[model samples]
Target chain A: MSLIEAPRTPTRGRRTGGINWEKWGWIYMRASGVVLVVLIFGHLLVNMFLGEGVKAIDFAFVGGKLSDPFWQVWDGLMLWLALIHGANGMRTIVNDYATNPKVRTVLLAGIAVSTIILIALGTLVITTFDPCPAGADPALLASFCEAL
Target chain B: MPEKSASNLVAEPQSPPKIRSPKRPAGTLYRGNEGMWSWVLHRITGVSIYFFLLVHILDTALVRVSPDAYNIVIDSYKTPLMGLAEIGLVAAIGFHAINGLRIILIDFWAFGAKHQRTLFWVVIGIWLVLLAGFIPRQLMHVFGG
Candidate 1:
């Protein structure tokens, strides 16, 4: 004979009747994980795997890329997506562990403020980057700039 | 039948009574569901971006150290493929930053359930507008303009 049986009334109460949020979190994790795999790997392949590999990396390498609009957009997308994905993931961890209401609120606020400041600064750098400034010392200028 | 002696009789062991532990109280506010998860992800991304910034700063500083080394680095950025990689980077930063703002508002519980979706879409709209302006500038520079 079976000992277990279903509840008679399904335990109707304030706690039992509410929204299910855990399901959505699980979904976001898997979704972000998939996208991250592509973005991260694609990033590595281009930076380290192509051409002369890691040795080819230098200041001009960055300047050359930043000079082009295509790279700027590419970098921009990666920046936004990865940052959001990472922040969201951390938020989940914080929610799970931070029990004290006041502490949790403070921590969350800190995260928000810092993320905003960084994103703004980073975007500015990418957009306003000047590879070869006119007044820059000749000694500091790249070979290409000297040619010009 | 002969009566059994006390020592000869076998005793049956009694089953232990089950003791149920008290259930923990469920968290308040949205019943601790999807919103909680979003909040968590927001923090994770925020930290990662911070570290990436550190590395980026060091790498760029090389330009000041040596022009030859800097040009070598800059040359790599010239490739078409590298251009695409950059797009990914921008998207990551933009999405994280905007969504992070949304999370901050949600924490205040000011918007309520009704306005959550509205706020989300508004953030998305802002991201799109910014991207539209940014992409063209990047392309023009890459193509040799």
Candidate 2:
């Protein structure tokens, strides 16, 4: 004769004692997603829908925005959050579809490398940006460039 | 008596095993309902947004190169074709954002799972309203000047 456990009895745990990276990753997606929605929407509204809309966008427009410390922080946060969020999402998709171990490894590596490089590059561009560069067409410069 | 017992212990002839198909054809959670469709659309839009983000970051990085370089590249975005593409990009982002919120609600809220079917339509309703406000404004910007 055998005895059965109660309905509410706890079962043996599947996960070993360690960090739960997957759980954190899952939480990161939703958290970053909420932030990115605000960041990216504000980005689009300012860059694409304001005043002259897309017509008003150019080097000058970007220079003007990037020159401002507020936008610098905005773009920087957007860059890190959105890139990591997207890279993680792509990792999930790749894990699902890429059946071959080698193929999956390669795809995952590509995502990781690209995300790192872009994040670094984007941060550099935002931090060290010069609104007005010398020997450039003065006509194309930001309006504030005239004051400078 | 021993020989008879040995003969009885012999195994029966074996047959080739047949592969058993699952009782459910599509998937466990996939019932062609709002849940399934919402999941599918979320993935599609997520992927599209990812690719666009990569390109967008590169374009913006051109600012560090030179004003001429950045302006010359960004100038192409004002073209009629790219203008239309912007609409699609915005649509994807809007859907992804709203639906992402819906997904969060389902995960955290007490009543969310029970009302998820309703939430999917709510996501669509909000997405449509956003696009309605955006499209006309964008069209005038794209085709106006």
Candidate 3:
């Protein structure tokens, strides 16, 4: 008779019913990563490549884009997707390195809170941003804002 | 069959049990090779991009404060030093993005693991091409063409 070898590591018995969040998180990393690659590259191309690059960025340049519904939606998506992706990646890192339970939980909570706050703030900025605010210097405004 | 006595067993000179050198060299796949280096680079770039995202969000949030507030903050991004930093940022992003796709392929595609080394090289190739196109234009924009 052959002697049976024990498992090298401890593992849980298969259980049913609850949602597998860790699995989903893994999937999210890959799925969101694919989308982010395209979204961020497009963002960089438009914002950094087309004309003056970083030198061209300013309040007017940003306001011009935010005022456009297309860009608003694009930036909104990018913000939400990228923030969560980053937070989740950080969570994985914390789990790997922060051995203390208290420290790990605190770090994970920090990531979650910051991600939520940034997503909300970014979304608000995109949706509520006004290119032509009254009483502001017209020099800093987008060219179209002058007509408005 | 008679069992060998302990004294006879102890007295017999036994050749060292043939320790078969492993079929494959140790420390190549997961330790020192393309797979390992790619993974290390991926972690480094991922952490860097994450921290940058946090700062970027805060900076962009200044837009809500006022136009002047936002412009004042953003003006710093246009400096020559920042322009050089942007190159590093883009390089990190390019590697992360390309290597990320390679990771996905390794996870989902059957041939991916078999070709992971190849995929890593491919990632570097694509990343170089991207930087090639980006650096010159960025230099022109920053230094004034």
Model 2 Cα shift for residue B108 (angstroms): 0.1
Return the candidate ranking by DockQ, descending.
Answer: 3, 2, 1
Give one digit per residue, the lDDT tens place, for model 1 in A1-148. 6578656533334355566666665555455545654665565556644554444565556666777898888776666655565555566667778978888888788767766665666677677777676666665444576677
Local distance difference test values of all predictions, in order: 0.61, 0.92, 0.89
Q: Which residue segments of model 1 deviate by more than 4 Å?
A: A1-33, A137-148, B1-145
Instruction: Show where candidate 3 strays beyond 4 Å.
Output: A1-16, B1-25
Tens digits of per-residue lDDT for model 3 on A50-110? Answer: 9888888898989889888898888888898888998898898898899798998899989
| Ten residues in sequence with the least summed lDDT for candidate 1 chain A | A8-17
Q: Write the per-residue lDDT of candidate 1 for residues B1-145, one digit (tens) a residue.
A: 3345443454545578997875975677655555555555456555556566545644554554455655656566657776665555565566666665565565556764457666767767987975775555555545543
User: Candidates' interface RMSDs, in order?
Assistant: 10.1, 0.7, 0.9
Which candidate leads in TM-score? 3
Displacement of residue A29 (Cα, Å) in model 1 is 5.3
Tell me, by lDDT, which candidate is best.
2
B131 Cα displacement, candidate 3 (Å): 0.9
Interface DockQ of candidate 2: 0.65
Scored against the true structure, residue B28 in model 2 reaches a CA lDDT of 51
